[model samples]
Target chain A: MSDKKKTGADILLDTIYKNGVDKMFGLPGGAIIPIMDAVKDHPIDFILTRHEQGASHMADGYARATGKPGVILITSGPGATNTLTGIMTAQMDSVPMVIISGQQATSNLGLDTFQEADISGMSYPIVKHSYLITDPKEIPKAINEAFFIASTGRPGPVILDIPKDVANAVIDEDYDDTIDLPGYLAKPELDIDKIKDAAQMISQAQKPIFLVGHGAIISGADKILKTIVEDMNIPITNSLLGKGCFPEEHPLNLGMPGMHGTAYANMALCECDLVVSIGSRWDDRIAASPKEFCAQAKKIHIDIDLVEINKVVKVDIGLVGDAKDVLEKLHKYLEPNDTSKWIKTVNKFRKDYPLKYKKEGKLRAQHVIEEMYNLAGSDVIYTTDVGQHQMWAAQFIKINSPRNWISSGGAGTMGFGFPSAIGAQMACPDRKVVTIVGDGSFQMTLSELSTAVVNKLPIKILLLNNRYLGMVRQWQNLFYENRLTGVDLEGNPDFLKLASAYGAKGFRIRRSSDVRKVLKEALQYNAGPCLIDAVVEQHDNVFPMVPSGANLDKMILGFPQKRKELE
Target chain B: MNNNIEKHSISLYVNNKPGVLIRTSLVFARRGYNIDSLVVSNDSNNPKFSRMNIEATGDTDTLHLMLAQLNRLVDVIHARDLSGEDILQKELSLVKLECPIEKRTELLQIAEAFSAKTIDLTENTITFQIAGSSEKLNRAETLLHGYKIKEIVRTGKVLMTRGEEATA
Candidate 1:
């Protein structure tokens, strides 16, 4: 008879596979050597990330794209610390990710051993839940809980801190535990009372504004936001984080409001008498001043997260549920309320700002963003890394739906866009998913391209090669006497060469007008992952500046005289 | 503002989870009058639960809220509102002084009396970290007036409500 003895590692891998994990993004370590050894023989693919943050981002990307939990593994100490940013990002964005970190042996847990940091404790604020699995027998249950917590409503990162001995120790459990999530249960069921109240408010309003946020995207409520906007014939103004929630090019889209927002956008926000805020938390940035944010509006706030409902600004009518569901249900009550004058005013504002960029060459960031919106059409999802590129994408990309605009909003992690796009592409492979990243942010987790290539997931990447930390430089211009300190990149990698190095198709655009051709070629080169090194202006910064801690209404409006000259 | 009024601040360490703050808040709600400035944060190196600072205004009503809210939040394993009847309390404050070089010696002498630790010393400024009751920290601040006082960050008040039977 064939011997059926299996090591603890085998059982662990089996459990992970049983949970439907096809891949893991991580770096192997001494503590997890046995698990790594077992996985080497298993069918599961272990992606080797350049950094632990990259692994977390890959997992986050995978999760965001797939609507499933992304999995990651890292060693102890610095490895665990590196993932803090990604974890906080996931927490803020509510992305479902399961991170497995190695810990010192059970005996050394409290003894302050080498390569030991209280990882579980450090990640407290950022994770849904975490565990230190000291016993082999508890591994299956802990993992089951981790996956459950990470995937449930209010989705966020969860950590499993497994001690070395526990990972190696043998246990004879069936390992067939199903997820038990009794604490969390969230669905998009419209609250009837609030909906009726909101509908009543919407009916009475003359000039209404539709303010959409990240919550709308997560709830897949773009169609709902669109339906309401179309039905009401109301203009839509987005927060900085809500930039891509609505299609920027849409006739009714008024663009981003608050600090760093266009003057017209903020004016539209202030002018609207009735505000229909969907899936958005009226954060300080968007609100400007709490008292002045929507001083004239009869606010109707709809969001799934209840804590965000009245946290910042009070609303006339607050509805808690998934944005899509609430909007869908509210559709019946809405009766095509016309606000022609309101739409006209918003159109005027949009015309005034026009999401403008100087006519730099064809390879400028503006062309890249415009082309991305054109090539991808209204169906593809677009994500972006933090920096000038993120703001540029936010300023330009015309998203037709909610979830189509995935981004690292609150935490603003650099390497989130690419990996998230990979996840988005993986989940909806038939639909195009593109990522816009700056050279600075791209280097943070560019290795994720390997995961996409290996998985045969074709994701288009627009590397806006601005060889400086654009956002920080913008800050220096306003705050720090323009010293420009530590913002410039002296030696940047050749992205086209780098993309080619990773077995992916690469393109380079240097002229102002060649953007369309390069982008068209990239979208067509769909055999595998592709990267376009769109050489953009190095000094270009996201304008309509609202200096830090400054009120939103006080935005500089992008070199006022220059703006008038453009007009 | 009411000097004669008796005040209590309770600090607790509990598992941090969704609905924890709600449960703690519900406790106060059920008892009437809510917490004044209830700050929920994690204890250093303890990931499972957080150290919650519950500052309640009313006397009898405060106790009820603390008891009720603690019971409500599933993740909140413990809850307490400190009272003078039980437990030791500590408040930490870091004050940045705009002291000229000449007044630096006087400020240092005052800081020593309060057991304050000097955190920063510049040509025109001196910063000190003082740990004690809110009143004591305030007194130390008053003594450093000759120098320019730039900013003050008070850690608020954290209390262990008497006769400790391990709340968590």
Candidate 2:
């Protein structure tokens, strides 16, 4: 509040602190030494990650878990580039993050100096916004604006690049708390007419389904969404990122739809007369082939971003506003209807072809996930890496609340689970955080085990040791005449021994009987992080998959077809 | 899988920053679309903003996706397809052709027919400057292509709407 001479680094830290950021994840480097030194004087808790990519994913996981903006700090050059994958992951999933990267001195820039790169230019496409601060006086305003842009509307990551000299320079100026961004528009008001039209369409349709997405969680519209589903007696399904928005145990809730989704959910989408999508972009995974995704349905799309309305599939009615606002308004104009016949049909479909797997010999990944769901109940936060393990977790794990299921849905990044679990654990110190990763995905960013050990984060790691890239192997088996290449991991390291090297607890289970016992032991081991490696079946493929370029009705259930052509 | 490629002219109004130009153009280059001509200049009324006109060749679906991506850029305030709008487009080009003593009179007559001005004249070369629509400039260049052309410099197209409805 006082106009005293302060260093730019101090102003930047003060601004972040004032914006309600208590923890930061990153590493220290040469150009960012001043900022690291200033961190000692501040009250923020800095978690030093082993790699910059790990730091970015940790921030993303923290944001998804707590509904707050995650902050990250890194040095110049390679440090900045290493965070690209993580930044793109956050941008794809709409997570809010503030990334501060240090740069070389202003005089040393453009001279091919040591560890100098155009961080702002490189990150422009991936970030929501970026700022390069050259003046000491502009430090506070830049930090404030970066946080505002990151956490508002369709939230995403933002970057602030500061030169070494700018951080060291002293300026006599007061911190400006007011944000003056003429170009940035966060939330748009709801159009009542569009909501009314959507309500009318839903009432007139014979069978209507509510397609919810991550936007519901972002807008905190779980209550309104539940009300709409219950009042109208409509069946509801969620996207991969929207797993926990609605309770999976509810009778009115169908599972996810599209590739790797349940047969009942995809059938319901194909048969419904109206598909009311809220806060979910019609991604390729969700819509498969957009032209024929729901040919029989009259679609209504609601989202906060105006550009995503008709980008994929054209909708009959498009409402550009917050999910909560639009749902609340639509509820006012809707009336209770009897959808008993439609619900009965959907129930029959669900009962006829339920999600099942063979349970005879070796341990299956689905069985382990089901056991974890039963033991952990509804109070745990779960994260998963890409590939077969992620799909298994999504299909079997039961999430009872919003913000409890976190994954890299859109980008499908492999090394996202472990560091993200650490972040989620940090955000909710009392809740149990479990990360399920496959053998191939776990090795990508295994160095983050040190971060958990150093911070004493009690995150449980579930490694599905299948010894192969399970998803790609399945694709090769089905589409490429079973000629697998480079999918085997024959000489993989022992995960239990790896955990021991990081000074943590490790366990292994090779039989179905030992699954529950080992999982219980890992969850109860509260001293530090625990790694439970479960050796599961190798050639098992996810069921009820709609092949590429196929419609929802053309699903391969249980196993591959007997003939070479379609039936 | 639409293979019919056609030229597209897109205009954007963006914040005038040091790296905004590269950021704006990268969107096109990443999509594998070749930008034939790109013109950028600061807005006279508002010095803080700049207007950019880019001409690229792409298919219909890819161009639509590119426009959506361009509008999502942080520095861009507004983007529009000026090719379909009622607008005026012009390009300026300076062409240097090899001219011998016997062919100097013939080259001057050709330049006079196309309303080109002789900007630079040497003993064996003449640089004629022409300003007109893109089609007109292409026609003039085609007429001078038979002669041995030494060099050519072109200022890309700039466009403005006909009525008072501002592009931004």
Candidate 3:
């Protein structure tokens, strides 16, 4: 430390390395050449992505899969602006990510020099925090603080806008590893009285339901949550981001609740006497009409972020602290309860409202997902893009492990699937990672296929080749009186040839019966990436949908499974 | 707007750095709270921090959440809404109004009742200095509304914890 002089770029890499980051995703540009040149000396693998947006999404995917902060490096102006969608996706879902965008030299700032942009200003609303390191000496502290802020509390994206001059400047001072954030409270002390209050409410309620969210996985409360649910005999539901927190195969789990959520889950939420939301802020999707989301239930919210409490809907008890800490405390006070009647009622609702499709008709996205699950099993990680395919994957695929289901829940970014799967595969090389995407969404960032091929990432792609933007078309079909506008994808290129162009294997299936055989072959191709273009029914719409401004009880259950034709 | 939708006096103690003030105000702007007035000064006991006072109007429904968001900023050390508390809040306003020879007597009488001091006197304009709560200042301005008001500069509220609890 005493013998060598270190430049700001070196210090940035050094500090991030000390914080346990080994890989980053980004593209090179003029303003970032100084840092790009310094990367050769560092141990971090710079996974150069095809587009800056892809880099950001890949990093987000990596972070979500591993529960660690993903790092990104790119240039200023267009480079920084391109990552906005990815950053907002991470921000909405609370994934941990750090981004470094190079700026013009300090002398050229505000003068609109080449590649100059106000990144910090542009990203203020989305980023958890940001640092403008015009001074070289601030590199270490800013890097360390960015990592700390992005990985703690309600994790999100943070950015560092470093000018080229600062990145080139050298310093000889030593950097110590002490974080001094006076106001950012990462771990709030447990409020025992509130936990006891929630526990007492749980004990007295005959009909109780749990709605766990992404925070449950973030806090590693899966095992404790499972134990609590089993002992209390409570039915449970999850948010889209909370898909893997509770095993979907468990009998007590009632699946997701919201606009396209399972009918039984929404009905249980409507009928429950007590609803405990563990580490979840009831977003608009979960409580679209907040006033009537659970008008009949006593709501208790347990979350680490104090701001999220009472933000969307008022709760009877708001416990502010880490989910794991509060759950452990509440577990001790919980007593066994007899909820046989309540359980039986919810089970009946589940049976009567089972999710279905025209089983004997054309191939559907849900069938492809189920066949993929049958072939890949619960061990493989599945990522999905936005729109119909995403909801279909969520409704059909049942992942048994936490951190195995990743998607853009809040932001609904369409091009998030392929790049994120590449990231997940890179992060977990031994495990299988597959992307269930639609034709419209897949073409949004098909350029990333080269990224996977160049990196030799063995990720699989299950393209639901439905020739239209199915979700929007469905809305037009139902609400807009069939006047579909700009929803067609007739110009999409041949996906199998597209995969072959990128040096990967591709397969196609036209019949529902071929789904299993094709998926088995695609899942077994371990040498490189595989793409399965499953031609699904074009007009199928997700059911049990609570339309905007409608309550959970107003679900439009699909064409009431035509009372079976008499023999 | 609801019954609680009224003006709120918020005080923030933050690092006296280049970008802290913008970050502080961004929170209000993003939350859709209208800022009526804002004042920033670097007279805090701690040199590393600056004091900011903002008079904004919004319902109390998400006010606490707004404060939490402000406190989450990197440069903000602490933030509080001192409204509805027995706190000593003061602001200074210099109001320059038309003062013709015929209106001088009436202006003097009105200034005396409001306890406003004459800060400047020109041939055509008289400027009065008023210091007190925002409500008092508003009332004083209403009395001089008949006169042609030329210009006014106000230092938004400065809050001090009334008894012994430290403001910071």
Model-by-model lDDT, in order? 0.74, 0.89, 0.88
Q: Write the per-residue lDDT of candidate 2 for residues A1-567, one digit (tens) a residue.
A: 345467888888989999999999999899999899889978999999999999999999999999999999999999999999999999999999999999999999888899999988778778888899888888888888889889988999999999999999886666565776765678888888888998999988889998889998998989998888888999999999988898988998887888998899999999999998989998888797888989899999999887788878889999988899889999999987779999999999999989999776889999998898889887899999999999989889877799999999999999999989989999999998999999999898889999999889899899999999999998888888889999999999988999999998999989999988998888899899999999999999998888887888888887744746534
Give the TM-score ranking, best first. Answer: 3, 2, 1
Instruction: List the candidate 3 regions with Cα displacement exceeding 4 Å.
Output: A1-4, A560-567, B1-3
TM-score of 1: 0.75
lDDT of 2 at A94: 93
Best by TM-score: 3
Question: Which prediction has more favorable DockQ, 1 or 2?
Answer: 2
- TM-score (C-alpha, index-matched) for candidate 2: 0.95
TM-score (all chains, Cα) for each model? 0.75, 0.95, 0.97
Q: lDDT (0-100) at residue A161 of candidate 2? A: 92
lDDT of 2 at B50: 94
Q: Pick the candidate with the highest DockQ.
A: 3
Let me know the DockQ for model 2.
0.42
CAPRI quality level assigned to candidate 2 from its DockQ score: acceptable
lDDT of 3 by residue, A1-567 (tens): 446578888888888888999999999999999999889878889998989999999999999899999899999999999999999999989999999999999999899888899998888888888889877877888888899999999899999999999999987666554777886788888888888888999999999999999999999999999899998999999989888888999999888889899999999999999999998789887798888889999999998888788888889999988888888999999987899999999999999999988767798888888878887888988999999889878888886779999999989999999889988888898988999898988888889988888877788899999999998998787776679999998788988899999898899999988888888888778778888998888888888777777788878788434423110
Clashes (N, CA, C under 3 Å) per candidate: 19, 0, 0
- Residue A394 CA displacement from its true place in model 3, Å: 0.7
